[model samples]
Target: MFKNKKFECYLLKNRIPGVVLAVLMTVFMLMMAGRFELFNRLDSKTYRTLNEIESISNPYGSDVKITVDRADYLGYDYFVDSERQGSYYICQQDGRYAILLLKSNDDVVLNYTIKGRMISGGSEYSSIIDGITSDMGIAVAQLETRMYPLIISEVDFPRIYYNMMLLVLIVTVLWSVYVIVRCIYEVSCPWKVRSVRDVLGKRADRQTIRDIDSQLRYEMYYDQYGIAITDKYFVCHGMWHTDVVALDNIETFKKLRTSSNIGSGKKKIYKLLMVDVDGVTYEQDFRSEKDINEALSYLSDDKRVKR
Candidate 1:
């Protein structure tokens, strides 16, 4: 199941082995349904055990026989007919006697027909499986004249598995929801919301810049949305940039100044004020993305800005 939203955070990815375990479990399940080579031989005892439930209708009727893929060890070629009864016989590698049948049921929930099959092949294989059924009196391939819907009726009510399944499904859904919600919060909430007044009051800790180095030059590098970090001499216009802006940063102010300057790129430099997009001041003058973040971080935490 794919989600519409991509979990954009940098998380450890597909390289993990968790996916491998999930795949192995899925394959193990398919094999349990007799899909693996080891279980092809369906002896009478096995058939009787499965038949006891009676509620699950093999969408494949008794008429269809399965195409025996392997018959070396199983010792039986098996099949089911139109009426939902099964039959088995020996396998001949020559392929002369191999036949398969399939049937499907119109299950309402899926809006499509679903099917299953019984196989017939391999004489040696058939002998081994049917040999167990010899005294059962009921042919393993004999179709039941009557079919019953799967339901539960105990002294009090129905099978608890049904309720359990519903409960499990609901829990899985809730768990998924919780995971997604947390992921969203983890990704988005740390990016605090800044208001216009918050933006105006925002300032960078100039002390950090001054303390870092004495011979620094300052340049304002900006676009409609971003700033580039370079030592001081202040290029009012940066040549190339591609990113969006966080409103409360000193770098955003720098980009704002750059955009409002006279010439493009290296040609112009000026005193930058707030950027007015649709009559609202949105940006500033500073050097680095770090500076931009400092201002945004301040407003995000400042109760005055929030108010």
Candidate 2:
């Protein structure tokens, strides 16, 4: 029933559109919070130890190739040369090097990163210079009006969970409630049948009882309201009824006194019966016990059946 409950909540979670949405919001969240950014950040944090540094020349290019003491450089090497190189250029900062040459193999090879320990020391360190590639005659400009640094901030919310979507969900819930209540009301009124046989038999067991169950529906309905019965089974809604038992049908009479019993144990073949003023043998296989009893009591002679 609440199949979409978890989904709906998840959509609005994390103050979306920060958590806004993707094809699979759950997948995106589990991925990195903001899509693949989560995994990307984690992988970025994982790096090979800096170890000792070394200098080497590619000899093929005018650039001087700087190597690291370790083997697992994560497939990256640095360059240190002021002259324009054959392919790429690299420079040093905070003990790490940055790459220039927008199309340089060095840029692709060297996995430059922002190290926290590098910046925390003091303002003697520069933010942009601390970034990779900024030292190679390259620079990044920032908005000056912002007094404090915006980096390392977790912000942005509400944009993801929109109001229109919420309104639609509310309307859907209301529709469901209305559907459920209407079904309940339909259930409150137990349906009934008018079996010429159940009330009486070929002999009508008692003709008086037969007349009661045989009463016109409206006449029977008014009297049956507010009645509580536990023993009888209600078949289908009265809008549809079954074939009625004939007034003098012998087989029908035999069916009436079955093993099935209410006030007492008796043999019976259970079937819902219905009555229609416009049809003969109004008794049908789909009547509610309410109607059957109403019809029976309608014809009560002992005055035992009451409105």
Candidate 3:
């Protein structure tokens, strides 16, 4: 597929834009990686603290303060001691104190106050850890609870950074796949142009460009294609099909200059025969000026041409 000259030309024409986009995407992915690494470390630190608390017999009395690392406030296992002491909830006063209400086995509510504040996870606010500490004199046997401070950070789960990187990756993969598929399709597409009578037949309209006006439409190109001019219309033969432009529809005709620098540093100019149909422009370039004039002469009577 890569050996095909037309596909090679297509790649050459689009290489600059493709490279520029790839570079931009790489930079953005790098930035996202940095953010994930930083926040991931922060979250891991808090999780390690929780692991440490599990080994301690009296975690609630410890001076070590830790914060919630995840976006949700209920980061630590809320039901860690649920089987022993039932369920617990925070009191809703000024929201400064962690007034935990424990529902006892006897259906009695036991209130325990702890010191803490609310923490935010970027957007939503959570009271996950902040600065919670249980009442100092509470017997461990009576409560069977760990009262260590859960100090958590407000920043959690870098969604914007990760989501943008994911989107870019998906787009890049899809675009690369599309380019490959399109190249394959184009390489396989067949093109042919017989005589006007053979292709268009005698019943088709064969008016010259000068006979039509702004309502006429056509398509033409120079790369990897050939031009055939009949008395009725000029046909641009491509891999798929041909576009016929009547001479009567040609509102304007001129030379369109184009250049390419595929080999070495030498600039090569192309002589493009530009024609207008309706408000749209169609153009085809030849290797030399003589060829362009000859192609135009086949479509129009006054073949002096314009530059």
Per-candidate total of colliding backbone pairs: 43, 34, 17
Q: What tens digits encode model 3's per-residue C-alpha lDDT throughout 202-228?
A: 423323222211122223222224665
Q: What lDDT tens digits, residue by residue, belong to model 1 across residues 208-286?
A: 2232122123222322233332333121223221112233232223223233444655533233343334344443445
Better candidate by lDDT, 1 or 2: 1
Flag the better candidate by lDDT, 2 or 3. Answer: 3
**Model 2 over residues 1-307: C-alpha lDDT tens digits?**
3232321122122122222233234343344334534333322332243222112122111112223231111122223375432232333334544323222333233443322111121231233334422434443333222111211101111212323444544555555555445334322211221232343334333333233234322123332322211112111122222122332221111112124565676534433222323332322321354554454542343422222
| Model 1 superposed RMSD (Cα) | 19.4
Residue 259 of model 2, lDDT score: 41
Question: After aligning candidate 2 to the native by TM-score, how far in Å is the CA of 267 from where it should be?
Answer: 14
Ranking by TM-score: 3, 2, 1
Error of 1 at 151 (Å): 12
Question: How many backbone collisions does model 1 have?
Answer: 43
Looking at candidate 2, what is the lDDT of residue 39? Answer: 31
Alpha carbon lDDT at 199, candidate 2: 39
